[model samples]
Target: GTKTISYGCVGGDFNEVLHAWEKEGGVPRSQRCLDNFKEAFEYCELGDLGFAGDAFMWRNNSHTAEKYIKERLDHVVATQGWCARFPAYRVVNGDPRHSDHRPIIIDTAGAAAVRRN
Candidate 1:
């Protein structure tokens, strides 16, 4: 059987937040889903493409001041080999359409590497 490399993105609220809280020792509580993602990421040697400016990608449609709030649920992940080839990937944020989740665009083709002496 031909070995086909597999890579994907998966996770919800990821309630815990970012990988690095700050410069100090601050580690957020890990959820089961996040844990699974981490494991898969390591298995495939995947790297994060990073979210745009806004931290939260999803939020409650309610107009209330503090309804369900928002969180970083959306993300991009790819195999290490893939990242090496295309290291200039980015996620773009656009106005939310019919849903609470805003649109995200992932640019796979990065800038060409420049050779210097």
Candidate 2:
């Protein structure tokens, strides 16, 4: 029998934004940095799990509007093999509470089950 390779999901605060739209009220991410991230993701065969709810996952917590900053620094990526196992997998950005960064929630039971009222 042929061997099967199992690649699991990767999730956390990378501290790097993959695109310009991911960041706001900042100096703006350099194109080189964005390309580097994209290259790495392609090389690793990883795909973003995406998210619902808030678009930004991190905030500078600044009081002034101009001094404030927000970005979707946290993310979840999975290989094709892992995604195939859970077709209905969902990723959500939870409330930050006391922290500047929001919590990442993942539900393999499908969005319907996780979004129950």
Candidate 3:
């Protein structure tokens, strides 16, 4: 039987808001949302399906540094069972085409993502 791989945009941020970003740019969201995502992730036994591309997946494209916002809000996650099935599986973050969120591509062509972004 083929293993299952779950992935999506997941519009909300995980854990606490990013303070490492620009000033006044990284507004923190409610901890409740973060906790919820964590609970689900653990319950499902999901792991970050590593990517090869820009560090941050979402950008506001703002000109002002203080107002600019960038974050790794999007991701592809997989379970241990799923990973065992596709040992060569990988994920690549695509350029954000006029959108705040970037596109995620699943690569199963056997070309492993060798570098950490």
**Residues 5-94 of candidate 2: C-alpha lDDT, one tens digit per residue:** 477899999999998999999699999999999888877888998998898999996899988999999999988989988887999899
Candidate 3: stretches off by over 4 Å? 1-24, 29-35, 112-117
Each model's RMSD to truth, in Å? 6.5, 3.5, 6.2
For model 3, residues 17-56, the per-residue Cα lDDT tens digits are 3224311355755567666766777666676666788857
- Reference-based lDDT, each prediction: 0.56, 0.88, 0.63
**Every model's TM-score:** 0.60, 0.89, 0.66
Deviation from native of the Cα of residue 95 in model 1, angstroms: 2.5
Candidate 1 vs candidate 3: the TM-score winner is: 3
Misplaced by over 4 Å in model 2 are 1-5, 112-117
- The TM-score of candidate 1 is 0.60
Among all candidates shown, the one with the greatest lDDT: 2
What ranking emerges by lDDT with the best candidate at the front?
2, 3, 1
Best by TM-score: 2
lDDT of 1 by residue, 1-117 (tens): 454675454333343434433112223346665667667666666666675666566776656654545665666666766666656655555567798776676665433322221
